[model samples]
Target: DLSKNNKQMDKIQKSLEAFLENKRKEFPRFFFLSNDELLQILAAAQDIRKVEKHCSKIFCNIMKLKLGEDSNSNQIYAIISAEGESVAYQPPVKARSEEKIEATLTEIEQKMVETIAKKLSKFYSEYDFTNIDKSSWVFNDIGQVVSAFSQIIWTELC
Candidate 1:
């Protein structure tokens, strides 16, 4: 019975790690946030009054989010002070423009992959990077990129 409970605990720990990994992969910027900061953002995502509370956590100096209400739809609008950028609640009845072209996560990830590929290319001339999966962890953060190069360089010298 003790062994069974230990196995279950191990399984639960693995599941939680996998969940955190998926979340991290979805937003690499979360890498900069501490466990508490990331968890708080995930938990308080639905609140805006908390906006004023979280300003100092994410921004510099005394910048604040000025909250206003639209009289027509009674929707809330938040203008970021100093920067002047804003976020507003868009009504579902409104039509959105479909013509905007944006680079995909994969495309951006591919660019990141190319950076490390260039480094490895010097030694492994035949290693083709044409089809590297964007999901590769090479460029998720600066530490990962530096660690990758360090491992390769140290191995070569040894």
Candidate 2:
């Protein structure tokens, strides 16, 4: 039963795809740009976060054109309008809280330290720095290692 249901859904999806393909051919101008192109355009012109809003507006406009000004279409548009209005009405808050900012910084520092440790661990067994003060030498060694690693794999590191 599950397999049959899945096959039926797949058939329906294929049929929908065909219908959309036909519509796309019929209205080439409206579907000229692919989704990636639209995303790139929005990303270049506006903040990345605003891309979603732009996409939603585009979708709603297309839906309105397809559905025309029927009662059901008006209802759907009204719902979309309300949601857009609500988003616009909301007050902007700080992007990150103090705790979250600190946590992110801590995470970044931990990763940097881990990377340095992993890179330098092989040297530990070969050389003896046991007599040296860890605070001074370890930091300096890490900096050198990181700088060297960054130079060698700068593209990958980024």
Candidate 3:
């Protein structure tokens, strides 16, 4: 009594269930691409801003899974507690100050850094650091990304 569309839907449903079952068998815990793996993927991206495209096309295929739905970026300073002897913008505070005044990446920011790292590693076999460029959003917002994501990963894991 099924129409062609119904039969097709039934096939899709069965296929998805089978795929999910296979995934469970493959990865005992949830599978996450490692930091290195992520870096490779990002490094290989033709346009870093178009990272979503590269990720969706390449990594999704390799991982056989979906990526996080959102991508966000921000800016933060890398505070230096003690300016080097010859560095500019010297802080008023002396060296070894107990103020704990060094830069700390926010929870969400850290997660983004880790995510980027994991994605970029997929493209670069070695130490690829295209995200370090100031012209790129990833580099400009690296600190914020690191801070944000750190908290996220911690909450999920711990």
Candidate 4:
């Protein structure tokens, strides 16, 4: 059986599709962003969004470590909360030792770096940084590339 949330999502999708169809009739080239660029933009956006979403968790975990918690409960909660907003934290009956917590945090940091690397691989494959026209492009070129699709985002609305 389809969950209520799923059903609601389906209805929303159908409505959006209908609205888009009408818009397409009025504007054939409704989507201004290039398809390939759009994908890269979205991929980069997700990474930045993920980082921004979990920054507090990461910061809190580091603070807890500095505070000498001597347990992995807070760190685990940080990871879970960072990864999934819906996740609930339940402190372990047996607390992890300080050494264990440090080791685990080290591992988590490595994994986070790895996840970022994986997400960036697709973008790196597309852009040729070595061949960039550095003279013409300024410091924000990289950011510009990431948000190339949504140029308006980088532009002033007013």
Per-prediction TM-score to the true structure, in the order listed: 0.36, 0.23, 0.20, 0.24
Query: Candidate 2's residue-wise lDDT over 1-158, tens digit each?
Result: 99999999999978866755664454333264565554353343322222223334333322111112443221111112322221110121211222322232233234434544665565444444334334544444434564554454444335
Candidates sorted on lDDT, descending: 1, 4, 2, 3
Per-residue lDDT over 1-158 for candidate 4, one digit per residue giving the tens place of the 0 to 100 score: 56988999999978866755554344333244334433333344323322223234333322221111542222333233332322212332222343332233344455544543543454456545546543453343333234542342235233
Colliding pairs, model 2: none
Candidate 2 runs further than 4 Å off: 32-158
Clash counts for the predictions, in order? 0, 0, 43, 0
Candidate number with greatest TM-score: 1
Greater-TM-score candidate between 1 and 3 = 1
- Candidates 3 and 4 compared: the better one by TM-score is 4
lDDT of 1 by residue, 42-143 (tens): 565444344235444443322444444442231233324353433222221121122111112122234435544664454345333444443453444234
Give the per-residue Cα lDDT of candidate 4 at 23. 44
- Mind giving the per-residue lDDT tens digits that candidate 3 earns over 1-158? 56988999999978866654554344322124443433443353332223333223222222111222233222122221121111111111121222211111122224434555764444334323433332443343334334554454456456
Report lDDT per candidate. Answer: 0.44, 0.38, 0.34, 0.38
Backbone collision tally, model 4? 0
